[model samples]
Target: MTPAPLTRAAVADMIDHTLLAPQASPADVDALIVEARKLGVYAICLSPSMLPVRAPGLVVATVAGFPSGKHHSLVKGAEARLAVDQGAAEVDMVIDVGAALAGDFNAVLADIITVREATRDRAVLKVIVESAALTDAAIVGACRAAEQAGADFVKTSTGFHPAGGASAHAVRLMAETVGGRLGVKASGGIRTAEDAAAMIAAGATRLGLSKSAAVLDGFPD
Candidate 1:
């Protein structure tokens, strides 16, 4: 399917400029903020610790439960709250992959619920299913549970996972399952304009990309 024509401004609004690299310095984040402000992307995703000092003009986003969702639910909840308090407009929390693999639906639900409640009035919650690590059925189940837990978006991967990032099949499945109830964010490995367009065609309303400048540079004004 062909992607709908998106203007520069529209494409800018769809992007979530990401900066989750281990080697990222404060100067790097400052540069990221400058780019985000210039492009007017949807948000600037940062590590939780950086949210306190990052650009207040940009919609601040941080990951909770992180690449590995092995953290305790309470810890995730506290992290979400603290990020929001530190000026985060959005919280992307990882689901417990082990619990989902074990069919422990309660654990998955509780983990998401805790973080969701903690950020209820403060920020939007996007549940990261880490799609690269799961089977098709597991991905669907995780999206459903995230919706039930009151998440505003179901995100594909954390980009740090060994398995890889967003896939067309996962994006389609999430869109079909969530319908209009929630947003689908496709992150990881999306470096080109074509990749961004493809994900948007597959029903992703948001794109989390570390290479936002490069991607937009490939498109004409």
Candidate 2:
């Protein structure tokens, strides 16, 4: 039988309403939290500096190694640990893109493992692979490394890469690579409901969206 059509509410539940602007103030983050609660999103992804925030019914997520994944593994681990200590329930860490580009997936695995060990049982670890900047082989290798490193999810982009953001092609490739063993998150450049749906159809289990309200507005009740 065919699956029932997805609803606006269902899609909202799959979103991590995001606000990672470096210039954003506490007031802006407060407003973001308020909006996330009102939207009924599953989580809020913010920068680590804006953490320790509380959103009653939603998960709190933050990034480490951020848009650039050049940080040392130990540094990323420390950042993840601190984020969790600051009340973040989920930590997204960027894999070293240079390592992946250089075909050093073992290095990628080691990097994620450090963050995993730091978060250890305290928070969920999502590895951001920056898919748009990678080749298909690199995407697969990164996903595999993340899985071996004990990541709970494999995410596509950081929304800050000039290489651009999530694509259905990239999402599909990532989904196939992980083979449902881990959650797949499609982020970056996802501005419309149509883009969201395409990612979902391509096997994305979660979405990172800055334009949450605008995208949700396009869906039916």
Candidate 3:
């Protein structure tokens, strides 16, 4: 069965209006804050470097170990802490997909734990599992590890992975695994109201969308 339509407030609350593109300029960041304030989006996910100057009055967020979760755990942890100190309300850290696929579950757990500890008091931590790169089992494993590491949410993708974006199956798996304990963020390639509703129906409490304006524009209040 299809899900009911999401109210404007519900859609607004679920969005982490994102601007992670390399071409994102200072003016773009400024415009983002203006739009976010107008829409009252859940947060404005920005690049870490922009945190110091652009974080005020914004629900500031930074991506850790970013698109490619290949960075050393220590580096990700340090980045997480720095982002928090710079006034980030939330930190989205990518999991080491290589380690996860190789069955190095300990490495995956350790990586998320490092950032989890670093951001414990300062900001909420969301671990991006990059679900498209993993098999169902791997997704479950990552969700379990994220929950164990005290992550506030288990995110679906980084939008850079060639594997693709949020899927209903992946969202359901994440929700079934971590819904009650930790929130699920369905990100990457979400561009329409219908897509947003599908992800939410599949159990996404948060959505990271770069195409926020288009999505909301198509769904008038």
Q: Which runs in model 1 stand beyond 4 Å of their true positions?
A: 1-4, 54-56
Which of the two, 2 or 3, has more lDDT? 2
Candidate 3: stretches off by over 4 Å: 1-4, 54-57
Worst 10 residues of 2 by lDDT: 49-58
Please report the TM-score between candidate 3 and the true structure: 0.95
**Which one wins on lDDT?**
2
- Residue-wise C-alpha lDDT for candidate 3, range 49-87, written one tens digit per residue: 777656455678889998799999999999999988988
User: What digit string (tens of lDDT, one per residue) describes model 2 on residues 1-221?
Assistant: 88777789999999999999989999999999899989889999999988788778889999999989999999999999999999999999999999999999999999999999999999989999999999999999999999999999999999999999999999999999899999999999999999999999999999999999999998999
- Look at candidate 1 and tell me the lDDT of residue 187: 98
Q: Which rank order by lDDT, best down to worst?
A: 2, 1, 3
RMSD, each candidate, Å? 1.6, 0.7, 1.7
